[model samples]
Target: MEYIDPHLHMVSRTTDDYETLARMGCVAISEPAFWAGFDRGSVESFRDYFRQLTDFEPKRAAQYGISHYTWLCINAKEAENVTLSREVIAMIPEFLDAKNVLGIGEIGLNKNTRNEATIFLEHLDLAVKYNQQILIHTPHLEDKYQGTRMILDMLMGDSRINRSRVLVDHVEEHTIEHVLENGFWAGMTLYPVSKCTPQRAVDMIERYGPERLMANSAGDWGPSKPTAIPDLIMEMKKRGHSKELIRRVVYENPKTFFSQSKPFVHG
Candidate 1:
């Protein structure tokens, strides 16, 4: 079953991980700009990181026959440095036209602070200005609910945003309804710890019925699995889900959402 891992930080992954993903049927992946485990001090650091994402990572993925797409932003954790965030956002335009570039993403609230909200709105503005699609990261654990709400409110308040073009990721049982019911796509990240597991993700599919919903590995430098989507495929099959139904969640759904980006030319 061929699939797409829509949100993963390949920069933190190894070449062996890429090989393993390809072996497990991952044909394409979209990496979102995220905090590099620490706060970066300057816009130049982000500029260099963007270059790595747009220029280097794609080439690396290509070695394994995987198409790599990317999103740019100063991630919420770093967005607290409002001045630096704005500078990084302003510099993102230089890479938007890159063939592998998707749009502004993995952009949403972390701690749901005022500065985070301000930077979130500014990233929204950048997305709107570029007519780009968005990929959002809701907060973790206890902060997830309110952070998701705050992110949604800001997005809903923006008149220029087309809800369908936005994806609110890391949704759990409590927050998935709000994202999908509001007309935006929702993503369930399968993780070994913290986020939804393969069984839990399959349960969400049973409840939500897979419309405008997708699953990802969210594989990064932390305790995550790059092959989690494949695990999800097996779980769905074991639960008697038809191949077509499982395909819709692991493959078709992401293709549909990511196709909205001009640079994402479906093959």
Candidate 2:
């Protein structure tokens, strides 16, 4: 079954990974700006990275017949530098009009610090002013719960935010309901380690019934799998899920959420 991995860092993967993804039925993907394993020192570094995301990565994905969409932001980990974060956020608009550009995102709390929250709200303001959709990254492991709540509260406090246009990703059993019940879309990122596994993702699907929910591999430079969504598809089938139901979560749900972005043209 053809599908879309809504969140993956192709910049960290090889060309072989792209070929493998295409072979496994990944028709398209959306890559959000994330920390490049370290804190960048200047706004120029981010400017160059945005150019790579908007200009270079799309061309690379096209070589394998995979459409690439991207989100632009400084990422939460780097948000600690308030001055640098603001500079990067101000520079993001230059790429917002790019055909493959989606919006300002993967922009939530990391350690849930004051600076991160300030930057998160600033990114929110940028998205609202530009009428763009958002993709958020909640903190990991022990920090996930409180970080997710902090991110949710900030979003809820904003009257200008259109709930349907925002996606809070990396949700687990503990945080999924909070995201969906409040009317925003939720993304379950399947990973080999740390995040939800294929079986667990299927369980969440069973419990939630698939409305406003989607799954992704979130393949990055770490120990992750680019084909984890296919793993979820296989697990769903093994558990006797109908093909239509599987298709809705893996394919249709992402399409529906992304269609809200002007740059995303459904094929």
Candidate 3:
């Protein structure tokens, strides 16, 4: 069963991740901008980071028959430092025109604080200006329910953004309805900890029924493995989900979401 991980952070992963993912029938992935596990001190840092995403990783992924796609935006946790976030946002256009760039993403509130919200709105404005698809990373743990609500509200208030073009990610049982109810695409993160696990991801599918949904392995600077995409695929199969269901959730949904950025991919 071929799959696409709609979200990942390949820049922080090793080549072995590519090999394992390819062997698991992974065909494509979308990576969102995320914290580098430390504070990046300069705009040049982000520029280089985007370069790595567009240039370095794609070549490595090609070796394993996996296509690498990325979303360029300043992560919300780091957005607390507004100045740095703006600088990173400014540098996004240069990379957005790269061949593999999907859109502006993984940008949303982390601590669910006011400043992070402001930065998230700014990021949304940038995405709208470009007519780009958005990938949002909502808060986790205790903050998730409210943060997911806030993220959806912000998008709804923005007359310029279509709810269908936004992917509210890392949703769980509690937040899934809110995302789907608003007609926005939902993304489940299959991680070892601090997010939904593979079993729960499949359960969510069973409970909610898939539509505008995608799953990803938010593998990154932490204890992450890129194989989480295939992990969920396996779980879905074990749960007796049909091939069409898996295809719609993993491959077709992501393709349709990212294809909205076709101009960016060619520009």
Candidate 4:
């Protein structure tokens, strides 16, 4: 049962993650540009970060038979500084043309502030201009509900963009319905502490019926588990989910989403 983790920060992961994922049947991943595990001082910082995604990480994944692709963009938490965010967004197109580059992503509201909203709109515009699929990271905890609503409203208001071309990520029980109902691709992060657990992800799939939706580990520079994706797959199988349904949710959905970008190649 091969899988595609559509949203992870593999740049922050260890080689062991690659090895484990390959052994667990992860064949490909789309690592999105995130907050660098901290705030960066300048655009040069982001420049170097993006290089690691396009250059270093792919080499690491290749050694373990996991094809690595990246979604390049400034993270919403860091996008509050408009100047730096703009600079990073400008640099994204150059990388978007790279071989393993997939799309512009993980770029929605963080704290749900005015600045975050402004940057998110800019990201949406850039994605539309580049004809790239957009991957959004909604806020977490108490902010999750409001942020998800705002992100959906803005996407709806933007007539130039297509909801189907966007993946609204990090959804929970509270946010998943709006995301699915709005005709957007839904992504549930399989994290132990901060996001959906593997069991909950399976429950959501059962309830939602796996249409235009996918799940990822979102493993990154925190106390996050990299094995969450494979765990979800295992649990889903154990629960007697049909192979076709499991394949569509865990493998085919991400492939179809990232396939919108010509640079992405699935083995």
How close is every model to the real structure, measured as TM-score? 0.99, 0.99, 0.95, 0.97
- Summarize candidate 4's per-residue lDDT along 1-267 as a digit string, tens digits: 899999888888889889999998899999888887678999899888888999999999999999999888889999889999998888777787788887787888888999999999998889889888888899999999999999999999999988878889999999999999989999999987779998999999989888998999999988888878878878988999888988998899998888877887795
Residue-level lDDT tens digits of model 1 in 54-171:
9999999999999999999989999999999989988999999999988998999989899999999999999999999999999999999999999999999999999999999999
Model 2 TM-score (2 dp): 0.99
The predicted structure with the larger TM-score, 1 or 3, is 1
Ranking by lDDT: 2, 1, 4, 3
Go through the candidates in order and give each one's C-alpha lDDT.
Answer: 0.94, 0.95, 0.85, 0.89
Worst 10 residues of 2 by lDDT: 258-267
Error of 1 at 261 (Å): 0.8
Question: Where does model 2 exceed 4 Å of error?
Answer: none
lDDT of 2 by residue, 202-234 (tens): 999999989999999999999999999999999
Report the lDDT of model 1 for residue 198.
93
Best by lDDT: 2
lDDT of prediction 4? 0.89
**Candidate 3 residue runs with Cα over 4 Å from true position:** 263-267
Query: 3 or 4: which has the higher lDDT?
Result: 4
